[model samples]
Target: MTRKDNSVARLYRLAQSARSGQWNLEHDIDWSRRPRLPFWMRRAQARKALSQLYHGEMATSDLCEALLADATEDRYEVRSCLGLQLQDERRHAAAYQRYLEALGGIDPLDDGLQRALTAARHGPFGNLGAMLAYHVVIEGELLRLHGVLAQFVPCPLLRDINRLVGHDEARHVAFGKIYLPEAVQALSDDERRALYAWLEGLWQDAADSALNRRRANLAIATFFRRWLGGGWTRHAKALDSLGLPSATGREQAA
Candidate 1:
């Protein structure tokens, strides 16, 4: 097939997968299968989860806007990927919002959420390569962390939500893997170096949220243990090979 044909085929496949995944989550997944949490813990866990998710939505919105602001016609593939990512992020945020409402309404504009938004807005813009690195490398780490969380969260509702979110994230990571190399290859050596530095800085920012938080009531500790065991390290290596510095390297640079 021609390159144009391949691109069309890939786009179709991604769209189809996204549609199927959406249908499955909405229809096939037994949302009712999970028992309700006890009143107190339900409120607590929901608050915590919803707060984190709201902050994530704010951050992704900032990133998406930043990407769109810099995008050109030549960057069609990257724009397409970012568009899909933005959609997924919005959907995930809506899902969390629904859960929060079901548990009891949550305050959407918390200080934590505002701070996350501010952080994303103020983040450095190190050209197209650096943007790809942030999406493909740093966000990929978050996807892996969520996968681990899906396995161990005690509440069935949360487990189901995390599992569904993980599936969507896997597709985002795949899209990144497919496109990031091309973006990196297009950059000059000096641009690549700047991109790497920007990525390392983002990695430090991500590590605090992805690895450091201590949620006393949830399975966060168990998830962290599994993440640290080998999984996260492997992910770090994969990201490193994709042009970002490894987690250890990021720490050293810091």
Candidate 2:
């Protein structure tokens, strides 16, 4: 789909990054950093933060599972790369779940987050459709917010966890970086319209999920702006790099 002869080769590097990059959540994180909540302390925000991260990641794990389930041997490089993604997402989910259990217990999914995941799952965004929603839209915003939250979130364990998650997410999003443009290029007109519709719904739910958190105002804004087309010119450029039209520009032209 790319104009360049080495395009798929560049995409192969996604698998390479998955194979060679990443860390073991258990061995890498020192769990002792989990803060002990005192009688006088209300760790409400911290609890919510870790809890939301855990649930969101678990949903991503499900998406990864879908990817794995649909994989075939013919698409060996791409499928194998996705095989690594499945492992990475599960490890991420487990690490965050462990962090939440350490805090107390399951924090449960917010209505908005659940809504987005469900929409992506039950609709045309199946397979590659879901992958774009996950990697391009969701993972892109997550990478940005995690970077900020890593610096600002209070708990040392949560902060470091955010940092670690961000590192892994960068590689996942790297896959998106190489995949989306070509995938978009291959889309039929109707398919592109469907992609835009799915993106609108996904972006809306993403914005809603960040609301009502008093302490996460900055993070919320960052997430919202990303969904609202702020981080998207960068996304548009990724498509342009493929010598294809940007999905956003196409939608506007349509």
Candidate 3:
């Protein structure tokens, strides 16, 4: 594919110029002020919410390391894009941890989460498999969950942080949509089948998560606007571009 026609190449070009930080967790956000949340949206809600965000960011961190290990070092454009994404993931982890601290600390990620992340680090995760899992599926869920959380979040600090991180996530997912198709196209049939198995399990986990359990309790169906609606439909189109039915984009998220 030529530069213009190649989505991943275009993403690399875009990432080169888009490397500027959109917001500083220290200066941009006024950390001195705590959010004035009601009783219901206070500790329990914050704990659940922050814990989710924290784990997600850390998982992305691990996924990035795996990607960097396998990605060609000579092709600095792709590697550079992933490097910037790594910075974003680390920033997100810091922001979430800080937010949790601001709320007097939130619940820790479960042992299951720790185990899963550890297993992923050791497991034979395929090349594009990491991209689709981390950037495509997980990042899409992050955007959706944040959009939903923003609507109900009473704290000004959290809302502002969400707004800033939300911008970063949009760009992150954009990179996934642009890059994954080309990456997956290069994968062998066996690799694609392995990825398919992985996604099937991922969808099942999302369906069973605490967030999905409470999704019915909330009035604001958050996934519709961007993730499940037009945005991810377009995203799924990118996955479909490879003509790999074995690893189709599954429509399930927490």
Best by TM-score: 2
Candidate 2 residues 19-101, lDDT tens each?
A: 77778887888887766443544566557756767777877888777766763424666676677888887888888778777
Candidates ranked by TM-score: 2, 3, 1
TM-scores, all models, native as reference:
0.66, 0.77, 0.75
lDDT of 2: 0.67
| Clashes by residue pair, model 3 | none
What is the C-alpha local distance difference test score of each model?
Answer: 0.59, 0.67, 0.65
* CA shift of 194, model 2, Å: 3.3
Judging by lDDT, tell me the better candidate of 2 and 3: 2
In terms of lDDT, the poorest run of 10 residues in model 3 is 245-254
Candidate 3 has a TM-score of 0.75
Please name the candidate that would achieve the greatest lDDT relative to the true structure.
2
Model 2 TM-score is 0.77
Tens digits of per-residue lDDT for model 3 on 1-254? 77435765676666865577546779998888876666666476667667878888988877777678874644666777777877878888888888887668758775544544444445466555556656655566566678667776767888888877877777776676566666666777777667666754654454344335446745534533223445434434544554344333432221
- Backbone Cα, N, C clashes tallied per candidate: 0, 0, 0
- The C-alpha stretches of model 3 lying farther than 4 A from their native spots are 1-5, 71-73, 111-125, 188-194, 209-254
